[model samples]
Target: MTEAAFIDIDWAGRPVRIEYQWIARDRAAAPLIVFLHEGLGSVAMWKDFPQRLCIATGCRGLVYSRPGYGRSTPRAAEEAWGLDFMHRQAQEVLPALLEALGIDATRDKPWLLGHSDGASIALLYAASYPQRIAGAIVLAPHILVEDLSVSSIEKVRAAYLETDLRQRLARHHDDPDSAFWGWNDIWLKPAFRHWSIEAEISAIRCPLLAVQGLDDEYGTLAQIHGIARRAAQTELFELADCGHSPHRDQPERLITAITAFIQQQPHGDKP
Candidate 1:
């Protein structure tokens, strides 16, 4: 079982609350797996998948909602996220959060399991601090912007404006507009069209498992394939009959793949 908790940290010179949960914390020597959610995802949105994966792999799990999502601090109405928002999360917030929780990445070398936008953040973090990560398992990561991604984002903008998407998202977020627009506006910005981490990702020295759904409307297989071309230890798994979110659509298969991947790593010895 997992239990939710909150912690306060100074971000941009102001105090901010971050919501997180831990699974299998009693296994002190077990490998750590940190869960990073998608753009619209909150801590609650992950449901029981993280707990299940932690138990299956005999690893400790840490799942958290980024700022502006779930019970964490909401994005102010006037606060427009910049093109490098995801970069900031990886370069700044993640490290800060881990430090606040007394998680010494240099010692623990946690594995990052991230989805969608979170997957992209994981890649950035691994590239920036390769030695601190044991490995990374990214699902539906974007190495570069694509026409398909832009088109899907446009459709999402339409849905949020004309449909019940806002109301639905409200169930997970304390301030739905803060979460929605913070992600939406940034992606749709014309300046963001050139956003690409392809060159930077080449610096990632840790083992990587990049998974993509064949039917993912937001991105193409090129996303994960691109990682393999640059990151030498990269493995790719393209799932059939799945969409953007594999954890929800194919939990069993995802779990099995991740378990096997982790087991293959040199430091993956069971506790």
Candidate 2:
């Protein structure tokens, strides 16, 4: 394990600072697994899942925060994220962060392990840069924001406003409002109700594993089913009694599934 490093990179004509933690089992050579966080996720929010998975697979791991969440710069107060925010993450932020860290997208097509919004981001990234991804494990991903998603988001807003949900989330983000409002406002918006990325998902060529919790409140099983519908090389896993966060809900199962998925992919380095 190494200490976290903070780096500054130019993103979309502005300077954006990023904090990342990298782990290498073989300093001389190792494949990479890039971990993307969920809607309200930060590097810290991932807990020890990245390390566990990397150790299990004997691969290097890259865990970092998006622009608006975690230690990264806060989103401009006036900047309202568009429906394509996830696309921007896949197209812009992810590529910028990888380049800044000297992770070659072409030479080392890293495995992607993403949760929730991060899972959607992974799907979009694979579609945009299919050749750059080896394999992917997406937990609680959303290809289309459904009525269930909106209804759940509405409940989240109410919880944040009426309960101590904000205080709980404050522990994970430097600016809780930046993380909470950015996700909540967008998910609860009327226009966002129709937000869907199924068209883009069709372009993904890498092996994919889509996992969802049976008890997921934010989304339904349809999310993973939709991914399987588009991508030919896709597998689905529905964990019983699990919720939105599969890694947290069933760490052992999540790890096992990912390890198996990577081992099944010919391109990924063996454990």
For residue 106, give model 2's deviation from the true position in Å: 0.2
lDDT of 1: 0.93
User: Compared with the true structure, what per-residue lDDT tens digits does model 1 show for residues 1-271?
Assistant: 5678999988888989999999988898999999999999989999999999998899999999999999899999999999899899999889999999999999999999999999999999999998899999999998899999999999999999999999999999999999999999999999999999999998999989999999999999999989999997899998998999999889999999999999988968677
Q: How accurate locally, in lDDT, is each candidate?
A: 0.93, 0.87
Off by over 4 Å in 2: 25-28
Give the per-residue lDDT of model 2 (tens digit) for 1-271. 5667788888889999887888773543677889999999998888888999888877889899898888888887877889999999999999988898777889878888899999999999999998888878899999998888888888888999999988888787778888889888888888987889999999999889999999999898888998888897899999997999999999998888888878767756554
Q: Cα-based RMSD of the predictions, in order?
A: 0.8, 1.3
Question: lDDT score, residue 249, model 1?
Answer: 88
